[model samples]
Target: MKGKLKKTVVLVGMMGAGKTAVGNALARLLEVPFLDSDDEIERAANMTVAEIFARDGEPFFRARESEVLSRLLAGSPCILSTGGGAFLAPDNRVVIEEKGVAVWLKADLDLLWQRVRHKTTRPLLRTADPKATLAGLFDARQPVYALAGITVESKPDYSIEDMARKVMAALSGRHDVMEME
Candidate 1:
């Protein structure tokens, strides 16, 4: 059954934290639309996020990210997955908090590394020592991510579905955000 969502659910966390995958499943479970901020940015720019970062630099990309986030958050409620750095910007955080509910998909460094180590698509992880960079990023972003409205712990044993359900469960407690009938 479809659950009613009064506000958009914005999935925030580190890269490879399953924001896209879990957000897709959460949208399915809720019977609502699923949107990815990075995908939207790519579509609008006619290029991938990595390309945007490489060509225009992170500052330009972040400016566009904030614009896309505001536009998306203004729409009807849905499950919106954001890039890892999207929530780090204070302006983005303010808009997101005003328009949607942020959910941090918390996972350990080892788990995040296991998921992203082999992936080349992550521009931030293109570093010479990505594991170290990822560790630094994870440590730095934890406090900002902690500011999210909800927290869903993720472990290796949790399938995408399990994570989605856990997110749903967290949302259930906030009557202003979700109400499953």
Candidate 2:
């Protein structure tokens, strides 16, 4: 059964944190729509995220990301998955705080690396030393991501369904965001 979703659930975390995968599962479990900010941006721009970052630079991409996020958050409640850096900006955080419930899919650096190491789609990880870059990013972003409304720890052993269920459980306590039937 679909429960009442009073606010949009925004999934935020590092690359390969399973935001898209887990958000899809969460949306299915909630019987709500699943939206990804990066996908939305890509569709509108008619370019992949990597291409956008490479061609237009991160600043331009971030502007588009914020625009998409604002538009989506203005719509009906759903499960929204954001890019790795979406929640880092203060402006984006303010809008998300006002319009949706930010949920950080917290995972250890090792787990994150294990998931992203094989993925070339991540533009940020295209550096010479991606592992070190990822570690630095993880260290810097942890404090910012901690500002989310909820935190769901993601372990290496957890499947998409498990993470989705964990996220659902975490949101269950927030009557403003979710209400179990």
Candidate 3:
């Protein structure tokens, strides 16, 4: 259980991959605090994530994400859910790997599409062909997601609580492979 070993568990994955939900449930199970990078950035900038992307662009948002990551990591033993692109940054990946345990919440292409289908607020997904865009994004991010210390495969029917329990069990060494049923 890198969470127990490292004193923190950081969730990293693609958008709509359940980082926030799983982080919250994992935090509750572990009796720790949960922090979401998007929420933190919103608080810091006084704007929604979509607004930040629209008004300031992604570079600005990435900068804000880095700042929040720094602050969150400084406060050890917290359960943190990072933005989809956050871990793609080399420094961010290094920080999460060194300072905390990174758990990648992965879902199949169809499942991911289903989870995010209703969202028009996702700046990246606001395209003529969102499904194709999502597929491309998933392909591009798979390797980055794989670098996490643990991988949790998300099911459409499973609640965050179910995933959290599996994560807890995995971290506790009761399960191997870090893949949730």
Candidate 4:
């Protein structure tokens, strides 16, 4: 809580894993900017993420996501939240690896489903069976997310503030990533 971040703390995980929410709290705790790649993409395209996906398709959206990530990473260290699929791309991973510390907010499928089930903002979840799709994505992404520099587990009982503090605690010991003043 009393430190200068040494590099961007990139939050990577599923849509409902609290990347954006935790990133904002963590950035406030660290006294730095909080940036979300999807927000940036939406801003640039003048459309919401779902709109972009619906109109241009995921490949086009992903290309823009990579562009946004690169631009965000090039700036000073901050809390950066990425889309769920951003880390799946090797190029984005390489850029984040070289320029930032990736922290995966790991949550179980059930936890994710509970958080996202009522939400309509998620384009990927709009399917015949969104729960099944989420489960599939969760299974496919876990191994890749495990490659992150640090991992903070997400539990149903943990509030957004609690998750943020957990991320801060993980970063606290890594002086190369975040150094206490």
Candidate 5:
């Protein structure tokens, strides 16, 4: 079934919460465009997220991220997947609240670690104890993510499509954001 996306759907969560994967699936299911803020940042800077972090530092990258988010949110509504740290910033959160519906893809720490551990792409997990670092980030970010407009629990056994369906179900109740036919 297809539905109208009245506002952009912004997926926010820790790195390995399947924001990109599930956002892609959700966009396909809803017949809307799918945009990734990190990809936009990388494209504009001609650098990967890790490279941006390594060279320009996080504050610089974050500034670029907020700029990209503002640009995207000002455009047509779509499914926007953000970097792990994007939603933690108050300004970004305010922009999202005004232009999009934020959905926290809440996943347990163990599940997040399992998905992100083998991925060397995550700059934040490059620490000596990556698992512990991930746990720390999870602890610190959960409260901030809880401020999202909606929460979709992501379980270890759930496939990307399942998570997307769950997100759709969560959005179904918000008539201002979604309309099912």
Candidate 6:
């Protein structure tokens, strides 16, 4: 019951879960344009994400996220890396599911923490114990991510490039043809 196979690839995951990195690699591998939702928001807002969070708040940011996602879907043959919370929004999830191949980049809590700790401006992870914070975020968001057609478990031993290749392979019918690449 899937729609027509557009060449667009949408990557979803938590912040610092490497969506941008992996999406870039995947875009290069597929030779498509790579679009990062956060970057698009920054461009449209004329401010950094930290500035947006400090001045406008999360609801505002999410609204911008939805706007950017919609515009991205209007195009074709592209790879998009969405904000960590994009899929949490029902409307955004529906748009992505209908328009493109949604791939969830899954990572363990520890790896997520290690990747994100150096970042000081994650509004959600500003808690005193970010480890517990990340675990809670993961618990809350994992089910939403599961709605994606593809789930890629990322680990230290495997590079994002590796996962991107796997995604391509899966999409090319080397894996489950019934599933999205």
- Candidate 6 Cα errors over 4 Å, as ranges: 1-5, 174-181
lDDT (Cα, tens digit) per residue for candidate 2, span 1-181: 3468999999999998999999999999999999999999999999999999999999999999999999999999999999999999999999999999999999999999899999989999899999999999999999999999999999999999999999998888998888879
Candidate 3 on 79-156: residue-level lDDT in tens? 899988999998898887777778888888999898899988788998899999999999999998899888878898
The TM-score obtained by model 3 is 0.90
**lDDT by residue (tens digit), candidate 1, 27-110:** 999889999999999999999999999999999999999999999999999999999999999999999999999999999999
Model 4 bad stretches (over 4 Å): none
> RMSD to native for every prediction?
0.9, 1.0, 3.9, 0.8, 0.7, 4.0
Candidate 3: stretches off by over 4 Å: 1-6, 174-181
Model 1 pairs whose backbones collide: none
Minimum summed lDDT over a 10-residue window in model 1 is located at: 1-10
Compose the digit string of candidate 4's lDDT tens values, residues 78-134. 999999999999999999999999999999999999999999999999999999999
Error of 3 at 56 (Å): 1.2
Model 1 scores a TM of 0.98
Residue pairs with backbone overlap in model 5: none
Off by over 4 Å in 1: none
lDDT of 3 at 137: 92
Q: Pairs clashing in candidate 6?
A: none
Q: Count of backbone clashes for each model?
A: 0, 0, 1, 0, 0, 0
lDDT of 4 at 44: 94
Q: How close is every model to the real structure, measured as TM-score?
A: 0.98, 0.98, 0.90, 0.98, 0.98, 0.89
lDDT of 1: 0.96
C-alpha-based local distance difference test score of model 5? 0.95
Q: By summed lDDT, which 10 consecutive residues of candidate 4 come out lowest?
A: 172-181
